[model samples]
Target: MRKEQRVKKNKEFQEIFKKGTSFANRQFVLYSLKQEEAQPFRIGISVSKKIGNAVCRNRIKRYIRQAFLELREDVQDNHDYLIIARKPAADMDFHEVKSSITHVLKRGKVLKKTSYGKNDRKK
Candidate 1:
């Protein structure tokens, strides 16, 4: 993701938490707000060092980015989303991370239930 597409700072995160909405599951929290972007939606990923070392955090971030990349079409367009990795996410595998993040997105109404179907079109 580019600099303008990502939510990188603590203040940006907090603002999203404030004005945006959120849904929490066992493995992650999805925070989102509407953006005026013209193209497809963009996402930001955040994983704290408190979870583990740089390696662990990067692993979690990679899994999440991959999950989102795979489901980009099913997600609503033009929304700014933040996927915050929770502690439980560290113990999960790739599919678990995908499921957990998908669950949160579903709960947030950013993604429809049928979005999980394997036959769904790619973005």
Candidate 2:
């Protein structure tokens, strides 16, 4: 993810927390705030000490970033997103993290609906 696409400031995170709408699953909480201007989406991630040590928290953060990278095209482009990882996330691998984030995005109605071709079908 590019620096421009990340929400790094404490102020920004607080604004999103206060004004954004949130969606959550068992493993993660997602906060989304739509921007008035046209720009690429930005994301902020928070992993608490309660989840694990630095290594474990970093791993979960990495997984979440990678998941967002892959889902970038499908996600709305003019919003700021904040993801907070729960305890169950520490034990999950990359794929689990991706699917869980996808689930949250879907519930939040932030992911675009893509029409799949016949050959594009899974299986």
Candidate 3:
């Protein structure tokens, strides 16, 4: 994600946490706040020290960012999203992280619905 697309300031994180509606699964928590004007969506990721050392924490954050990048076209614009990693997330691979994030976003209704044809089915 680009710097302009990331929510890096503490103030912005606080605002999103305060005003956003949250959704969660076992591995992650998602907070989403809709903006009044049309703008590109921005994302903030938080993984606490309690979860792991710097390397592990950074890995989780990277996974979350990659998930969002892949889901960008399906995610709603004009919103800010903050993702907080839970303990279980530290052990997950990239695909697992993406799946967990997708579940939370769907529950929050922030992900756009896409029609799947027979070919799109996994089996």
Quote model 1's TM-score.
0.83
The local distance difference test score of each candidate is 0.80, 0.92, 0.90
Clashes of each: 0, 0, 0
Could you give candidate 3's per-residue lDDT for residues 1-123 as a string of tens digits? 999999999999999999999999999999999999989999999999999999999999989999888788888999999999999998999988888888888899988767122222564
Prediction RMSDs, each to the true structure: 3.1, 2.4, 2.2
The alpha-carbon deviation from the true structure for residue 40 of candidate 3, after best TM-score superposition, in angstroms, is 1.0
User: Clash pairs of candidate 3?
Assistant: none
Q: Can you write out model 1's per-residue Cα lDDT over 1-123, one digit (the tens) per residue?
A: 455656678787777888898889988988888877576676778888878889899999889888887787788877889888888888889988887777788789998566565533352
* Model 1: ten consecutive residues of lowest lDDT: 114-123
TM-score of 2: 0.93
Best TM-score among the predictions, by candidate number: 2
The candidate maximizing lDDT is 2
| Model 3 stretches with alpha carbons more than 4 Å out | 115-123
Higher-ranked by TM-score: 1 or 3: 3
Candidate 2 Cα misplacement greater than 4 A, ranges: 115-123
